[model samples]
Every structure is written in C-alpha cells, then in structure tokens.
Target: MTTMFRKALNALPRLGVQVVDLGPGAAVISRRGRYSATKVSADAWMVGGGRRSTRAPAEGWGLRKAAASSLCARHVADFLANYEVNCVFDVGANRGQYGRQLRESGYRGRIVSFEPVPDALARLRKAAERDPDWWVRPVALGRSESVQSMHLGWKTMNSLLEPSAYGQQRYKRFADTRTTQVQVRRLDKVMDEALHGIANPRPFLKMDTQGFDMEVFAGAGERLDEYVGMQSEVAALQLYEGSPHMTEALAAYEEAGFGITGLYPVTREETTGRVVEFDCVLARVSSVPGSAAGVRP
Candidate 1:
C-alpha cells in the first residue's frame, strides 16, 4: 500500500501534497494540513490541485468526516446529566474515544483528556482539535509524579503494569507488545495546574487504565471530594500483577463514600463464559449537586 501510494504521489508534484505517516498503515495527506485528516483517503489524489470531501474537507467537521465516534450509553448519559458534571477528566484516553462519545451524547462541557502513548496522543489531539473546550494532556496518571515504563498493548490494553497470566489466557491479543517510558503525574496535581482553582468544578472522572484503575484513583488524592460521579474499567480476573479483585474494588469504593450504580460488561472468557472485565459506574452515596444541569437536551 505504501509503495502504491508513493508511486502515485511521485507524479503529483504540481500539487502541494504533503503526507505525514500518522500510524501503522495510515497516512494523512493535506495541502498544508489546514484541514484535519479525520477521514482522509489515499486514493483521493490531486484532482485539479483542490481538496474537498472528494479529495479533502472543504469546510467544518461533520458526520461525514470519520468513522462513527459515538456510544449512546443511556446509563452514563443519565448519570452525567443528573450529576451536573461540568468538568470531565478522561484518564487513560487512548484516542479521545470517550470524549467523542460524550460529545455525541450532547455533552458540551469541559473535557480534559489524558494520554501517554505517542501515536495515540497524536490521534487524540487531532480528534480534540475542533473542540475548543476539549483539552488534551499528553501524560499518564499514577499514584506518584515520575516517569514509568508503561506496557504497550493494542492501544486499548496498554497499562503501567505487565500483563498477567490471567489476561493472556483470556486474550493473547492483549499481551504487552512493547514498553515506553512516559511521564506520570498525580491527578490532584494536574487538576491544580489545569483548572487553576475554578470554583464549583463538579468533576466527573472516567478512568479506563487497564488494570491500574485504583492506582490512578490514588493519584486523585483528596480531590476525590470534588467529584460527583465516576466510572472505571475494573478487572474481574488478575489481569495485572497486584491487581485488585472486582469485589475488593467495589468494597473500597463503597467505603470511600461511593456506591455501585451500574456494571457494563467489557470482556469475557470465551470458553467458560465468565466475564473477565467490566466497567463499574459509581455515584456518591449522598447527593450534593444537581440533575440535568450541564448537558444539552
């Protein structure tokens, strides 16, 4: 595919075609990158030295721009609406997947996304480019502020912990494929710098840190008091070393003044039919804020 595209591009010198390799088997072609490559096509060669939807986007970001970037999660939508959540901390955001979903669900508030993977960060930045309120922080969150070697998986399963045997048995595809030294910061510290002490933050944390969810939560410190709700991807099996059991996580959250509101299945052992992973949606044990406040109808 590269050879074919290179050979074709060889003849388009008259056109100001600048192509940048964005990821594996993916490239972004632009006149000068004035428009984003949300749905770029390598086949859309220089037609009269102009780019449109047929060649490149001529106008704004729209539904025709890229693949479906929406997850109509009714439960989450209801929770976010009811919580009056004004600030969303999207931890372990690989490529702005959840932020995009929130936008599609009519959420028009501050979405701060954290991503550590370089390749994934580029994609996340591109996705966040059009949204003025969406900010992307190229870093990871952990219990401490330092550099850590993060295990790289297929972008989704990447984590700060090595894949355990329990994970490999469920899916060999989730094995740690590589390692990268990434900067890690405490969530409480990051919020101080990013938010600058904005009053009434009404924060909602959405954590999908593979098996390191609790570690990431620890980074939040006392700032957990500012959150109205949270949702985390919890491992049922020991997917990583020292990973807490799902029940333990639930108990801990309950002790910390939160309650399990919903559980969404994420993965299961194909052979035994036991769910290996699920997302735990949590809300404060006692209400303090609002209902349907910061979301669009």
Candidate 2:
C-alpha cells in the first residue's frame, strides 16, 4: 500500500520532488511543503519505486525548462509543425540518443544516423533496430572520399578526428591508443549515392562532430540548399589542440547561406574549467536585393 501510494503521488502533476544523494547506500527524499513551495527533507529508503542510491538531485522546473529550451526545442517544434521534415540527418550520432529523443518528442521523421566509431555504430544499430524509419551508417564525414586515420579513445564517444594529447585525456589507459583507419566521404557524395532516390532534396540535419563541423559543411559546398536547418555543436575554446574554433566554423555556415537562429550553452557552471558548448541552429536565409555580406539573422 505504501509503495502504491508513493507511485500514485509521483504521477501527480505539479508535485515538486527532490532526490538527495547521501553517498554510498543512503539517500533522502524531500517533498514540497503543503503550505509552502520550499522542500522539507526527510530520511527515506525509497521513493518513486526505486532503491535508495547516491545520485544527483532532480532539477527544478526552471532548470528543466531551461535545459529543454537550450536544445532549440522551440525551433524544432516549429519545424515539425510547419515544415516538411520528412527526413533527418543525425551526423556523429553517438549511440542514437538524440535520435531517440527526437522520436520521444513526437518527431515522426525518417532518421539517417552516422557514426565514425565502429563500436558506437554497432551500438547505434542495436538501439535503432526496432525503429524501421532509422538507418545507421558507419562512415566519417570529411572533405574527401578516401580512407583516413582516426583517433579512438577508451570509450567510443571520445573518438574523433582530432584527439587531444594533453588536458587529462580520458583514453590514456588503453594499451593501443594510436590512429585507426576509417572510411571517410563527403556529405554531398553520400547523399547523392544513398538518398538520391528520395523525391525531396532538403532534410533537417543535426551535427555534433567534436571539431569537424566545418569540414562537413565544406564537403556539402554548393549543396547547402539540400538542408533546411542544421543543429551543430560549436566549441568556442581550444578544448583539443587541433580542434577548430567556433567562430571560424560559424563563418563557413554563413558563407553557405545559412543564418544563425539560436545559441545555447550546455553547461551552467563557470568554475568547472569546462568550456561552453553551444547548440546552434542555422536556417537557410534568402538573399536580399541590396544587402551587405556581413548581415546576419
């Protein structure tokens, strides 16, 4: 009866709940007071049908809304409702998390996910196995069509074209952290070969390549019209020694006739030594009759 009541309470809307981690085998539950919005902490074994465990507290409504809004959810929602986004391109798809999020967010569009790492590609394939609308590709997007050496990390998510040699590398424990050969192709070539049969040319794209976002845009070249909107991760700091700056990459998108619509930071804390990653969305802007090239949307 207690468990059932707790579950029922958790399902109620507007009920504020807080999970407090107490280290090793202990935790606390804090519920909003009946008379006030302030949380009243309590010692509890379990809440919401889960064992007491040390984990981060659930974010407040404000933080949750901010996080969701930062991902350009409003723009995506507008595109889904207004535009014909029948197809979506998820470049550098890490384990298909973003694809799953899209599906969960009511996006009924065909997804083409690309991951360069073999392990990640395999995982992505397994994750999207039940979704018939999704297709997985294990190829790196670059400027040329050839075999290129890629740096692999201990974890597949850390794999990228440019790996850092310093700054607390995560994959240093691996016995063989050298570069591995991988197939690389231009986005235009891949689209021409794979998606040529589709009647529509333009597709909504989401790119999150660590530092190779510009290369992928360059490979698209004159085929920029084939995409209506793009959401990409822009790294502002020199996180990796060989990584490109966000400003340089945004300029490339502007040259390709795209306008920046949104810029959101992924992290909130400024003292963590972590550089802010911007989730940027670019839309194709029509050229004006007598406008300077420097004008932006």
Give the per-residue lDDT of model 2 (tens digit) for 1-297: 446545544555345665444434444555653211222223212223233223423333333335545346656655554555667888888788788878877887788888878778888999999998788888988778888777676464354555455323433444356677888788888776556457754577788777677777777767767677788888766445566778987887887777887776653323353544578887765422124732335
lDDT of 1 by residue, 1-297 (tens): 457766655655467776654445455566653444333233331121234554234433332222111121556776887777778899988988888888887888789999999989999999999998899999999899999998876657788887777767766776538888999999989887666555657778888888778888888888886677888887777888888888888887787778888886666554465767778889884654433432322
Q: Which stretches of candidate 1 lie over 4 Å from their true place?
A: 1-72, 174-176, 197-199, 288-297
Sequence-dependent TM-score of model 1: 0.71
Give me the displacement of residue 68 in model 2, in angstroms. Answer: 5.2
Give one clash count per candidate, in the order shown. Answer: 1, 0
In Å, residue 248's CA in model 2 sits off its true spot by: 1.1
Best by lDDT: 1
Per-residue lDDT, model 1, residue 224, is: 81
TM-score of each: 0.71, 0.69
